[model samples]
Target: MLTKFSITRSCALRKFTFLFLLLSGQILKAQSPAADGKSSFTAKLINIEAATTEVFRYNTTLHNGDAKSKVVELKADLPIGWMISFKADGSQVTSVAMDAGKTQDISIEINASATADPSKYKIPVKAVSGSDTLALNLEAVVKGSYGLTLTTPTGRLSEELTAGSHLDIQLVVKNTGTLPLKDIDLSSQLPSNWEASFEPSKISSLEPGKSQELKARLKVPDKTIAGDYAATFTANNPNGNAPAVFRIIVKTSLLSGWIGILVILLSVGLVYYLIRKYGRR
Candidate 1:
């Protein structure tokens, strides 16, 4: 009951089945080598440390177990608001070819934003060559930022001054950051013939969220004009410096006020005398 057409169809079916099995076996063999190759390598994380806004570098070692070199691509899973860079053998690179049965060194640099949170972070890193993948975990401990703020007790940035007199003002220096600030030197910038000084001269250490009261002594020159002047108070630490501007309003002295009153009175008296003489004529 088998015709020529049936015989041809049977042969076609047999050829198609043989071709499909051969292709499938070849794909499985190719993919299996990569999965097996991953077991021949290891990734190690070393020298991972804490950092602030500044950049921090870490090292990664790739140890090859097979008897051949590998061309691997490097990648990282960094947190939001953070950046990372990679280097190999002291040169900037995104990948490297490791030698057979030897190790390669990679440098990783991580940078966080200024407003990033101060806490511990675990970033994931990976190296891949084809389907062979090696994973690593990097631990980063973030150090808090260093900052300080200077202001007056009453929050007023201006004060009145009398010529030839002494003025006393209180200022509050607060640690407005996460780290403890030490050796904060206080200084002032004033106009000519004016003097200013801080009570303690410098701060030993200002803890986080803590404030200290400081007395500022100011003396105005006798020949100063009755006008506005600008004064600057600066707080400097090892990290950086902060500046606060204070407006100074100089007023006339008591003697000057009395002299002006006497001059006005004499002018009024002369005018009254002149009017009386003219009316009599």
Candidate 2:
């Protein structure tokens, strides 16, 4: 009777322990997030700041918590004129395959319009697998871009001028970027003894996509050699600089040409007179 009771007690203890373990496992499963049969989309950084001309990159992950594998399709809602793409394993992809309780690493590339204004934009990205959809919100802060372009109104870079005279050139200064340009100073690199001046030597401010007209007075010194010379005109600011090279062709004045003709005629007349007088003697 004692041996039988001991054996029965041992079996009862084992049964109670097994029941307790089974109950504990059920409770733990209920508490686990993955056990809920839900998916997740997460990113270490959801907000980024960059210039309008630069590309925005975000590193993210997609997690599958379901009991089966899934083909997750990725998508993003972006503003018009903006572009977005996804990459997995260094290759461009729109969907990824994930096994149960597995995770996938992805990269999101976004490009805002080059002319986009400086502002904060919201981008909503989603991962969908059948009836399950996981969403993530991303923010992009676009900064201003500074750029300048200096050229003539007619797009001609060459000019002709007479020596010892001044020429008035119309210069068009354009703000080629998305931001305003301020305190832009005008300057030039010319040959020695040459003079250059702008009507408005300094620009207070120029708006994006807008142009300002300025008069550039270029003076060539008297007696300058007749040849093609290079003149570089620059519009400079703290942010950027635009330099334009112009070809200048110098020619003697019409009065000087007439004087040369007279001199040549006089020399010919004198030589003819000398030859006749000396030959007769």
Give the number of the best model, judged by TM-score.
2
The digit string of per-residue lDDT tens for model 2 on 71-149 reads 9999999998999999999999999998877778999999998888999999999998898889999999999798899
What tens digits encode model 1's per-residue C-alpha lDDT throughout 176-212?
Answer: 7778899999999999989998998999999877999
- RMSD to the hidden true structure, all candidates: 12.6, 7.1
Error of 2 at 6 (Å): 29
List ranges where model 1 is wrong by over 4 Å: 1-50, 55-120, 124-136, 264-281
Displacement of residue 194 (Cα, Å) in model 1 is 0.9
Deviation in angstroms for 262 in model 2?
A: 4.2
TM-scores of the models, in the given order?
0.54, 0.76
